[model samples]
Target: TKTFVEVQQRLDDVNSKLHETVSGAREIKSFVTELDELEKFDQVNDNYMKANIKVHKLMSLLDPAIVLISNLAIAAVLLVSSYLASIYTGEDKVQLVGNIAAYISYLQQIILSLMLLSMIAMFVSRGEVSARRINLVLRTVINITNPENAIKPGIIGEIEFKNVSFSYNNVNENDDKLTLNNLNFKIPKNSIVGIIGSTGSGKTSLVQLIPRLYDVTSGEVLIDGVNVKEIDLEYLRKNISYVTQEAIIFSGTIDSNIRQGKVDATKEEIEKAAKLAVADEFIEKFEAGYKSPVNQGGANLSGGQKQRLALARALVRKPKILILDDSVSAVDAKSEALIKDNLRTLKDMTVLIIAQKITSIKDADYIIVLNNTGGLDGFGTHEELLETSEVYKEIYNSQLGGYHE
Candidate 1:
């Protein structure tokens, strides 16, 4: 069992290393670190080989030892029974022969049983290890579940944070290490809100709260006058669309990927979404159009193309609230402008754009400036921020370098 566990652990490490090496192959070549990566892979592979050999060696010894013990027991029983039968001929030779035959038969049965156990020992050890690994995941406590009577809400896209605070780890609400500390804001329905912050200022964390991805450590998050925790998880998520910073693409056709947003979406809806995201411009050029196959992780597409496709997926849902977490950062300036203009036309849809560049959200209805200390510095229009927030002004100057918006 111990040797089997070692083999499993080493195999996992080897697989992890292989994935990392393949994913970052370009970086390795550019940095001229091929030898270093190869060395790392070799080390893990060697460990896996050694662990596997140990298991094999143990099995080799165990099988032979079991067989040898069984054979020795059978030999002793036969030799002793035959000798006693021959010597005790004075009393019923026929009865002594019957006893010897019975002893031999019993010994053969025991040997067969031992051999069967030896054959299945490898399977038993493997099953034990696999079961233990699976049980760990099954035993994890689920921290979120639907209430007894979960509300299926009719959403209008208004969002509010009332003294909300959050921490990834277990910590007090008043703890300084909170990711978002005591946030208070109320966004009207159909408004374009821009969230900007220095890196690690909890911009993503704050938006994630709207969908109840993580329940607040303290306070409440309300959507359309209802506490988010009271709403049905699936229903609430259906009304919200979130495009994360890293666009994830699965192995499938472009149409299939987009349909992930709304499984029953019509051809017209799909085309419209593609056009709105400006993805149709490139997709139409493909011979297969929407039927074009996308490689896993979008290896065939450019960074900008992947981001545009992800945007199209989000827009296809036509949700009441759209959250773009620096999603347009990879696209060209013209495409970004078009995307922002299209967003303005989505009636009654609340939009939150988290951007690193001030120009990305210069015309936003409201701009939220999150300070490096993990709290809001200001929340207002662009002009309002320029006048009030030192953080905003610094960021603006650094990016624009005196260029007018």
Candidate 2:
């Protein structure tokens, strides 16, 4: 059983690598623009090939071992029968012959049965492992679940973080290290709030809490004065639209992907969302237009095109709160400006933009500057932050080619 488990693990690893090699072959080919990259690809392929060979060798050895054991059993049976026949004589020998014939048949049946049992044992071992894996997943308990008396919020656009702190590891909550430290801020209804910080400063982590993706370890995340944890999970997420940093496109038509945001969205609504996201410009260029096929992960489209399509999907939702987590990084300056301009037209909806570019959030109604320690450095308009926050001033100067009077 232990040997079977080890072999099964190796087989799974090899299969995973084989799948990656096949699926990412085109990407690897495109990325092999230099000698070093080509060499790396070759090295990875070689390692996978070697591992595959080892597994095959182990499996090949099993057949010979089984055959050899069967041969030895037959030889032993023949030797014993020959000795018994040699010791018998006349009528007793005749009777012994008949008995030996029946015994030989029984011996053959036993050997055949043993071989079948061996095959069954191998399969049963593998099946047991697979069953255990499935059972583990099925038995897993979800940490985040709605309470018994969950409440649905009346209005969800307004968001507040009250002395909230979060740690990825809940086992040791008292540890000084945390992903987000005592964050206290309020975003009013119908406001455009921009969050900017250096990498690993918890920009994405902060916005994720708004949608109740993760519950705060300490303090509370409130939506319209109600603790987010107390609200129904489905109700909270339904009113919020979150566009992640990575533009994840599915294998379907452009229209189908956009319609995922709102299943019952009309044709006009889809087109309007596309236009607002600036996706219609390129989408119209295709002969199929809205019906154009999009490959899995949007591999056929450019980075900017995929980002715009993702933005269109979010826009179609028309949620009360929209969170864009570095969603415009792939877009050019002109297109980014246009998208921001269109976002301003969305009334009665709170928009939160997490961006690396200062220009992306400079004109936002409120700007939040987070330091590297997961704490707020400053919170105000771009102009106010520039005067009050040295961090904001440094970011502004770096991006805008130095400060001006």
Lowest summed lDDT over 10 consecutive residues: which window, candidate 1? Answer: 85-94
Residue-level lDDT for 280 in candidate 1? 95
Off by over 4 Å in 2: 5-92, 130-136, 171-174, 402-405
Per-residue lDDT tens digits of candidate 2, residues 1-405?
Answer: 555555556666666766776677777678864466556556666665665566467656766676677677667767887897899878887887677678667766776776677667768876887788788899999888998999986864888999988887763445678888888998899999999998998999999888888878898998889998898899888889899999989999999999989999999999999999999999999999999999998988999999999999999988999999999899988999899999999887899999999888989999999888888889999879988988888888888977664
lDDT of 1 by residue, 1-405 (tens): 888888899999999999999999899999999999999999999999999988888778876787787678778877887787777766676777777778778877887887788769788998899899999999998887777799997899999999988999969987889999888989999999999999999999999989988889999999998999999999999999999999988889999989999999999999999988999989999999999999999999999999999999999999999999999899999999998998888897999999999999989999999998679899999988888988999999999885346
Model 2 lDDT-worst window of ten = 32-41
Candidate 1: residue 403 lDDT (0-100): 33
Instruction: Report lDDT (Cα) of residue 300, candidate 2.
Output: 87
